[model samples]
Every structure is written in structure tokens, then in C-alpha cells.
Target: MPFIDLRAQYAALKPSIDARIQRVLDHGQYIMGPEVQELEQALAAYVGTQHCITVASGTEALLIALMTLDLQPGDEVITTPFTFAATAEVIVLLGGVPVFVDIEPDTLNIDPTQIEAAITPRTRAIMPVSLYGQVADMDAINAIAARHGGLPVIEDAAQSFGASYGGTAGTPRESGSAPRGKSCGLSTWGATSFFPSKPLGCYGDGGALFTNDAALAQAAREIRVHGQSQRYTHTRVGVGGRMDTLQCAIVLGKLERFDWEVAQRLAIGERYQRLIGDLPLQRLAVREDRDCVWAQFTVQVDHREAVIESLKQAGIPTAVHYPKPLHRQPAYEARSRAATPLPNAEAAARRVMSLPMSADLSEAQQDQVVAALRVALT
Candidate 1:
């Protein structure tokens, strides 16, 4: 089966997507068009944030967020070592230091307990990635940040845009009373990707930054457009980070079905966990208070290479979220301030494997993957 069934998704939303694209074409405002503002409004409303600033890419969203914070050289941003390279890359790119922290074995998110010890006078922000569609412990992280002079907490929510954190509010049940919902909205800043494969993806690269702070939102808006507070007025240093109009249209189209897609992802993830329970591998834990959107539906396995090979032979495709810890990466090795050993991150990098997952993934396809995995382990 295809790694991620974007084709199926497109087929389902063809009419709306076509109309949205056609409208953009008619307007001919390719750059920073009306759709961009419309999308920003929709996203801000969806996430319960006061403002949403669309950016060129998820990486840009993170970078712009940091720029708005006015991070300076030698300033530190504490983050997990187990996330995508872009999570920490933005920090180092701006001449800021990335302080590495380990992850929780179950959620594979940055461990909040380890964050305070890593904090220093130069620490400017705490960036925690919501890996594999599950949010990190933001309440505790926020508490820690509050204790430390209200340090900015940026949720690297590239994977967990739709996923909810029950701890902050409560959990939403299928039929029962809604558990309070909190995830991306639970931080000082939330950054999410609209890369085509994400749960809330657009047709191409697009992303957004969400925050309630009016000043930070204004700063991010400026940063997205070469730091121009007004036409040709450069207020601060910035990047060409504005999301294209066509991309914004695509995201708007995708948003129409996003709620259903999120439900499908949650259901499919639960099914995968249930069906694979009899297998020899270890499934990712979905905490009682939170759910994973299954951005990767990852599982821990021994001999991951062998398992992947077996699945590939059976016509199933799989991928890895990350293969190396940031501290071990050549680019960050010299720049990172990793005081403690990232044993969990390192072990997870070697063992974690993501299976083919999408709202469109079928039960038969899932069964085939499981059977192949069983034989591979044997």
C-alpha cells in the first residue's frame, strides 16, 4: 500500500479543492492573498488561539516564532533530542544554543522533569515537540516555565495539531461527556505543519504559528514578511517566510474534512494497537489522558531493519520518524549543550519504526502488515 494515501484524500475532497484553487486563480493574488488571511483566521479559531500566522514551512514557523521572541546568540532553547532535525535546527541556525533533554519512553516527547535542571541564565525558551501526533506534558512544562520567570514555552506541534491533551483540560469521549481538550492551545506558542502527509495537511508545504499574545503575534507577522511593520518599513530582521496564497487555499479545502480525518486517524490507530497486541513488538503507548493522531503509528521493535524488510517484501511500506538523536548529529554536536546522556532518545532512535498509516488505510492492509511483522520476528 502507499505510505500515506494522499490520493484517497484528494479524491474525497476534489470538488472543494478544485473550487478553492479556481477562486485563487481568479483573484490572481498569488502571494499573500485573501485566502491566506482566511486560513489564518480559521486556524486560529480552530485552535482557540487569538492569532495564527501562516508561514512558508513548518521549519519557518518555528524559526519565526523564535525570531519574534528575539532570541539572541548564546540564548538557549531547551528541546527534545528525539524529534525531527528541524526542531533543533532552527535554534542553531539563529546562532542560539540548543540544550538537549531526554524524552519520556512512552510518549517519546521531551521529559518535563529533566527540563529545569537544564535551564540556565541564558535559557530563553523551552520548545517541546509533540511527536507522532501526541502532545507533550504542557501543563507541567508550563508550570516549570512559570516558575522560571515565565519562560516562553513553544509547542513544536508539527505532528499533533489535531490531537488533544486531556491533562490540561480533560478527555473527549466518543459519546460520553467531553473531557476538557488541550493540546496546541496549551502553550505560549504552538507551531504546526501542513506538509502533505500531516493529519491536517495542505497540498504542499505550509505551516502556521498560533499564540494568544498580541505582541508576539504582531512580531511573527512582521517576521514572515521581511520584518516589515508597514510597506517597505523594515522594523526588524526577518525571513521570506509567508505562505503562498495557493497553499492557503489548499489548506482551507483540507480543513473542511479535517475533523473527520482526525477521527479516522484516532480510530485506525486504536485498531492497529488492538490488532498488533498479539504480535512480538511493543506498541506506542496512548496515554489515558491523550490520543495520538498516528502521524506515524510507530511501534518499538527488536531488529527493526529485519521487520521493515519483511514488510517491504509483503508490499507494505514503512518509515522512521528519526534515526539519530540531535546531539549525535554532526551539525549540532558542537553547538548543543547536552549535560545528561540521552539514553532513551538514543535507544528509541534505534528501535522505533513507523508503519503505513492514513485515514484511508484499510483493515486488510493493516492485517497484512501485522502478519508480515509476525513472520519477520520469527
Candidate 2:
């Protein structure tokens, strides 16, 4: 009944994980070691991007990506209000205004339709978060960005690294598919987290930035190490954002069965949808063109607090993906402005609850959860 079941994943990949860690330890190059480059290359190839820059954390990934974009003070970045704080946190930290946009009711993703209206002359970028491991409508979003003089689109893909977009249903198109675009490869800049609970995670905090622009890639590389063009030549202002070598090695180990894990997550999420179909709740909508790896298998329920208490009594663990929208939060409300009414984001915050989910989630475990939920609702 572990919420994310990381222990099970570790048990499954122990041998490879142990070996990878051992290799890192033996080399004694903890900071920006060979494994770091190896992981960057592997992830770049997997994501089908020209460059992949690893950073200390998902926040660092977003921060570095924004830095590379030259986000100036008072610049605005339009993004959904429904995502984790990091989506907007980076923008605020960089002295950029985060213009809050509403999310789609069903998908809980940033509504592409609302984006254009939010774009003012100060708007510098569009940051669309791929919430709940499903990518937002990148095609439509990209088209909008193009219409507005090609505003850089930075996909905050923290929960969607292994997910695919624009693919035919039931296809194994992780990469090497012309028609399908991987989550991190779909935009100008895609930043993803390797936080332990993500679809693709490492042992500790880690994240990466992916982009096709070589100049931007070079800029990010320099920024991650205090803006070092060479050893001591400081090119520009930057942060200590490098993802250590050991974390990179752990991610490489996790990548060994990442494909299979993605498949399992998809299947498990579908089964959850089906099992909950008759329940008094709203299932998250997955678009026909894309898949959610179910970073968290979330659903909307009435009287969420009661349901949570009941499930807790039943020994079933559940969590709220978010309890409040960013615009309503204390830290962000005064700082960020809502470009559109965030009705969906607010409603979702009150209703959405995540059940225990992982690639390692068992059928029996899933059944137990559903049964408990059913009783809770009744």
C-alpha cells in the first residue's frame, strides 16, 4: 500500500542499480563525471532531442531553461494554475511574472484556448505543464506560440518524461517514430523531473532539460556550473545546478526497464479507469492522441475529505495531487496574476485525489484499493 511503491521498483532493479552505483563510486568522480555525460546522451537519444542537460533538480531544470531564454525582470510566462508550484516558482524566482491560465476540466492540463488571451506584450514564454503524466495539446499550443512571433514554449514535463504524444493508439512508439513525439521532445524546451515518485525517477533529486536548439543547449550547460564557459571563465550569471554524477548513474540504471515500466503504467491506469467507471467520481480524461503514464492515477470525487478518511480507515493510501490552485496560494497569489478565471483549477484542487499507483502496482493491490474506494463512496 505504498503510495508510489519505490521499494518494489528498487527490488526489481537491484542488481543493475547496485552495479551502476558501484561503478560511480569506483570512479570517484561524483560531480559532473563520465556517467553524467553518458546519461545525458542516453536520455537525449531516448527523448529524440539534440541536447539533454542534467540539472540538480526539476526546479533547477526549469530555472536553467528560463535563464537560457534570458527571462528578464517583469517578463511574463503564461502557465496553468493547476500544476505543482515549481511550474510557476521558477518563473517567479527569475523575476518573471507567472500569468496564471486555467486548465481543461477533464484533462486538468493548461487549456491551449486560453493561452493567446493571456499573452500580453510582456509575455516572453508559454510554459505548459504535462500534468498527471499526459502531455498537454502541444500541437495546438505550438501553433499558438508560432502565431505570436514564435514565443518560446517551455514544456514543464516534470511528470511526463516517458509519455508520448501524437501517436496512434496501442503503438510502442517510445522513440524512432516519425509521427509520434516524445514528451520532452515536443517543444522548444522540455524540462522533466527525476524526483523519486515520477514515472522515470532516480534515487534522489535530478532533472533534465531537452531542446533542439544548440545555442540554448550550450547556454544551459554553462549555466548549470555557475556560468563556466571553461574551467574558470565565467560566461554569465548562473546557479549551482549540476545534477551530480551518482544521481545520473541511478537514472541510467532505472532506464534499463523504463520501457516496460511505461507499458505497465499505461495498462494499470487503464484498468483503474475501467474499475472506477461505475463509481460516483470523475475519471481523468486521456486524449486519443496521447497516453498518460499515470505519474499519479488521479480522479475527482465529491466529499473528498470523507472519501480520504474512509480509505484511510480501510488501510488504502490516497493523496491529493494538489490541494489549492497556485493563484490562491499564499506565496503566489500576490505575486502572480490570473489571466483567466481558474474555475477548473479551483474545482479540481478541491476534488482531485490520487490513489496508490506505480508500474509495480499489483492487480490484487489495485483491486483492494478500488474495493475500499467503492465502500467509501457508498
Candidate 3:
């Protein structure tokens, strides 16, 4: 069985995807066509945001969001060290510092309790990553940000596009409540990816930004197009960050079944958890109010290498979400600002393993994975 069953998804949506692609082909305005705007509109509506600016990639989406905020040479962006490099890469790329914070042991997300201490006069923003398809602690993070002059909170929703955070860490807020709300529409800026394996992925690289602020949305729109206010008019320094029309078309097709896919992902994740309850390994924590889309159905286990090998021999695929904390990476070692040791992040790095997951993942496949894992652990 494949790790992520994209072929199954493609087979399910082949007709719509083919027709969408054909329409784009006939138009031949591949650069910035009508489909782009259509996708932007569709995504904006889906995410309950006023604006959705499609970008070339998830990294670009993060980079553009920071650029729109006008990050400066000594500015610091508070973020978790337990995420993909791109979460911190964008900060360092623009000459800003990445202030590393520890993650919660249960959710593997940034610890909101440690955030305020990390904030300083040079801090420009708070970037919280929604890891493993579940949103981080946004309520406490946002409250801290608001206390400190309303620092721009950027939700790195790359893994959590469809997930909602109804404040289980605290009281259960309404669907769109302040500070504790949906993932992409929760904070000052929401950036997500479509890396062909995400819950709502397209065929190739694509991503979008979400915001309710019109001025910031306008700034991001300009920044994506080389900071141009008009055609060939360079107003500010920027990058070529527009998502191609073809990719937009693919995303449009994928959006048709996105709601159903999210439901399947949640159901499959629950089923996996229930099936694995009797096993010795520790399952990932899905909060009471929020759901994980299970971009990767991850669990913590001991003797990880041996278990992985055994699973491999059983014809079951497994992968790690991330194996190293950003602070330990050679490129980021000099830049990380870890006030306290990241024991949880480091522990999670060594133990967490992701099983084969997708909306199309079958019960038999899930049982195979669990049985293989049981044998591997034993």
C-alpha cells in the first residue's frame, strides 16, 4: 500500500480534474488566468476569510505573509522549534531572528505558557504552527500577543487547513470566536500549503494565505506579484510568488470533495486511534473540541528504528513527520533562541512515527498497519 493514496483521490475526481485542466488549456492564460481568481474566491469562501491569495508554494505563502508585515533585520518571530524548516526558514531568510519555544508534550504544538517570556522589544510576530493536521494553542498565544501591542499572529496552518480549534485548552468558544477559532482563520495571518499530500492538496506545489484584514491582504497581493501595484510597476521588493493557473485549477477540482475528505480523514483518524488503543504505543492527542485531519497518522513508540524495519518487512510503510528540532539543525543552530531546553520536542523527534494515511485509506490497510505495529513492538 502507498503511504498517501493520491491515485485513489485522483481516480475519484478524475473527470472534474480533467475538465478543469482542459478549461485552463483552452484559455491558455496560464500565468494569472481567471481560474486563479476563481480559486482564490472559492478558497476564501471555504476558509471563511475575506481574502485568499494563492501563492507558488507553502513556503512562499509564509514568506509573503512575513514580507507583508514588513519584517526587518533584527526583528524576532516567536515560533516552535518542532516544525518543518520552512516555519523558521522564512524568518531567517528575511534577516529576522526565530525565537524558538518548546512544544506541548501531548499535542506536539508550541507551549503557550512559554510564549510571553520569549517576547521582547524586538519581537515582531508570533508564528504558531498547526502541526500534524491539528492547530496549536492559539487562544493563549493570541492573548499574549494582544497584551504585547497586538503583535501579528501568523498561524502556520500548513498541516491544518480544515481543522477547527474551539478552545479545548480553555473554554469551548463558538466556531469563529476570537483568538480561539478555526485554524486558517484564527489569527492575524493564516498560511497553508498544498504539497500534494496535505488534507486539501493539489497536483503539485500550491498554497494560499487567509486574512480578514483588507490592508494586510492587499499588501500580500502586492508582495506576491513582485510588490507591484500595477503591471510592470515595482512598488516594493518582492518575489515571483504567484501560483500558476494550472495548479489553481487542480485545487479547484480538489475543493469539490474537500469537505467530504476532511470528514473521512477525521473518521479514519478516530478509527485508527480506537483500533490501536490496546497497543503499547502512545497515540497522538486529538483535543476534545478540535479534530486532526491526520495529514500523517502519527504515534509515539519505543525502539523506533526496529519497529520501522519490522513494519517495512510486513509491507507497511511508515515515515517520520520530523526527526530533528530546528535548533539542532546546522543552519539554524546559531539562530535559535531556546531559553529552556526543548526536551519534549527532542523526545518527540526520536519517538514519533507516521503511519500511511489519507482520506482513501481503508480499514483493512489500517488493521494491517496496526497488526504490523503490534508485532514490531513486541
Clashing pairs in 2: none
lDDT of 3: 0.90
Give lDDT tens digits, candidate 2, residues 1-378.
799999999999999999999998998999999999999999999989999999999999999999999999899999998988998899999999999989999999999999999999999999999999999988888888989999999999999989988754444444543335789998899999999999989888999999999999999999999999999999989899999999999999999999999999999999999999999999999988789999999999999999999999999999998999999889998889999888999999999999999999999999999999999999
What is the clash count for each candidate, in the order shown? 2, 0, 0
lDDT tens per residue, model 1, 51-164: 899999999999999999999999999999899999989999999999998998877888889999999999999999999998887768888998999999999999988888
Encode model 3's per-residue lDDT on 1-378: one tens digit a residue.
999999999999999999999999998999999999999999888778899999999999999999999999989999999999999999999999999889999899899999998888999999999999998877778888989999999999999998877753334865544654567998899999999999989888999999999999998899999999999998888899999999999999998999899889989999999999989888888777677888888999989999999999999998997999999999999976785679999999999999999999998988888888889988
**What TM-score fits each model?**
0.96, 0.97, 0.97
Deviation in Å, model 3, residue 76 alpha carbon: 0.5
Better of 1 and 3 by lDDT: 3
Q: What is every candidate's alpha-carbon RMSD to the true fold?
A: 2.9, 2.4, 1.8
2 or 3: which has the higher lDDT?
2
Report model 1's TM-score to 2 decimal places. 0.96
- Error of model 2, residue 51, in angstroms: 0.5
Poorest lDDT segment (10 consecutive residues) of candidate 3 = 168-177
Best by lDDT: 2
Global lDDT scores for all candidate models: 0.88, 0.93, 0.90
